[model samples]
Target: MVLIRRMLAFLMLASLSASVPAFAHKDHDRKQHAAEAMHNSAHQEGAPAASRMHQEPMHGAMEMEHSADEPPLTFTDRLLSWIGRLHPIIVHFPLAFFPAALFTATIGRRRASFATPVQFLVVAGGALAPLSALLGWLDAIGMDPDPLLTVHRWLGTMIGALGAALAVWAWRKPDQDRSGLMMAALTVLTAAIVVQGWFGGALVHGVDHMNW
Candidate 1:
């Protein structure tokens, strides 16, 4: 009976000892799995910062390339913008002068009261024409050359010369029929200047002639 009891006790202890190794193995496996999961999580957290660092140089290089491709603004551009604004005002003098002179002279020849004012308009117009021509020439030369540019140049020159000639003749005349002749010359010159001004407008606003 004692032998039977001893055998039963030995069997229970052996079974308990075998179960301890299996529990220890399961615990070790769980710890290994936790360690691997922590390592993977750490790598995932660092990935985006590493990617941003790798791409930063490429973004900087692209920006530099874009800057290199763009052209720089220049002094000539500023001068041209200023001149463009002034061009319309400068062109009107020649358009008004010759006709005003003629009208005044005709009225003065008939009535005598409109002569002085008309003469003043003629002289002022004549003076303004040359200045306009000079500015026009500067604007033309500053731009790329075109076929129509020559026409503008010659017309401006002719208008300026005619204005100056009429002005001089008007100045020299002693308030007689010769003043009428000078007024007629101014009238013709005024017509010519108006045509020239129209062409200049067409060159600027209509065509791409003067524009860069």
Candidate 2:
């Protein structure tokens, strides 16, 4: 009876010892799984912040590239800009002379005395037209392209061409007012100048400048 009791006690002790190792292994596995979960969660939480940190420098680099694209203005560019500014001042000469030529040319048709003044006005206006157009082109440098700009540019070009043609005609002819062709050309040029003035006013003021 004593031997049986000792055997039973030894079996119980072995079973208990085996169960302790399994319980310890389960606890270790649970701890390992929890540690892995914490690491994964931390990484996920930091990912967006790390991504933003990386993007900030990239954005700054893009801005630097954009800024570096434009070179510094040279002396020639500055000189040209200065010359271009003269466009506004020089433009008034042609503006006054062309319309005055039209008036004189019309009146000169009746009186030979007015012919000299008509020829003078035409020559002065014609000579200044090309210079004004050139200066205006320079003034418009680097301006953004738009509908009004297109119309203004082409209109100025046409006026310059017409002015040159009229000047050459007057130079060859004895009396421009007597010639029907010269009178018609003068009328057309005057009309164009008037239209140009309106566009220029629109540019200075607003599209609604004519409303009043």
Candidate 3:
């Protein structure tokens, strides 16, 4: 039963993970367009290669062919792409773990027994947050630049850095501080994640994805 549940969860995650070749395909199209434009100019100068390209009208027919197809991904390329796709899945861990840690820490104010869970959650989030951020950066490669992407990328970087620092702070000071500084810090981290999530959704859906 446990194995079945785990398998189902894996399947769900795999379904959510999109293939990376599409991103690379966009890069390829840009390069192809640039190359063809250069060749088009060269054809004006009677270059042999451009002479051959002029045999068919690009805007009328050749453009359709180039736009319709991209080079196929090899098994190894797919395998490597799977690594970057892990970002979407791995990010959930810190999102849950950080907030849960904050909650656990809040409750631990009344019951000391909650201390262990708080520390464990913080440590777990710290371990995964950097990996998630790294994968996110990898996934962003070859994607078109945008303001939303800029905000999401750097914000995620900050989250990963702060998460690690928060974990270290938790480990060093298991007991509450006089000012509750760690709790305050944890709150900031959680808030950042929420904001980053908004930008991420905008990137995935559209800028007005949440519009009424």
Give a tens-digit lDDT track for model 3, residues 1-212.
99999999998877666445666788899999999998887767677667667765765586778866978777876766778898999999999999988887787767767888888899899989998999998788667989999999999999999999877777787775212787898889999989999999999999898899
For residues 122-156, write the lDDT of model 2, one tens digit per residue: 88888999999989888888889877877888899
- lDDT at residue 42 of model 3 (Cα atoms): 75
Compared with the true structure, all predictions reach lDDT values of: 0.74, 0.86, 0.84
Residue 3 in candidate 3, Cα distance off native in Å: 52
Better candidate by TM-score, 1 or 3: 3
Most lDDT-accurate candidate: 2
Query: What lDDT tens digits, residue by residue, belong to model 1 across residues 1-212?
Result: 99999999999999999999999999999999999998897788788878889999999999999999988758987676577566568878767767777767776776666656766776777787777777777666556777667888888878877777666655665365236567567667767866776677777687654566
RMSD of 2: 33.3
When 1 and 2 are scored with TM-score, the better candidate is 2
| lDDT of residue 157 for candidate 1 | 79
**Which one wins by lDDT: 1 or 3?**
3
Cα-based TM-score, every candidate: 0.55, 0.66, 0.64
Off by over 4 Å in 2: 1-70
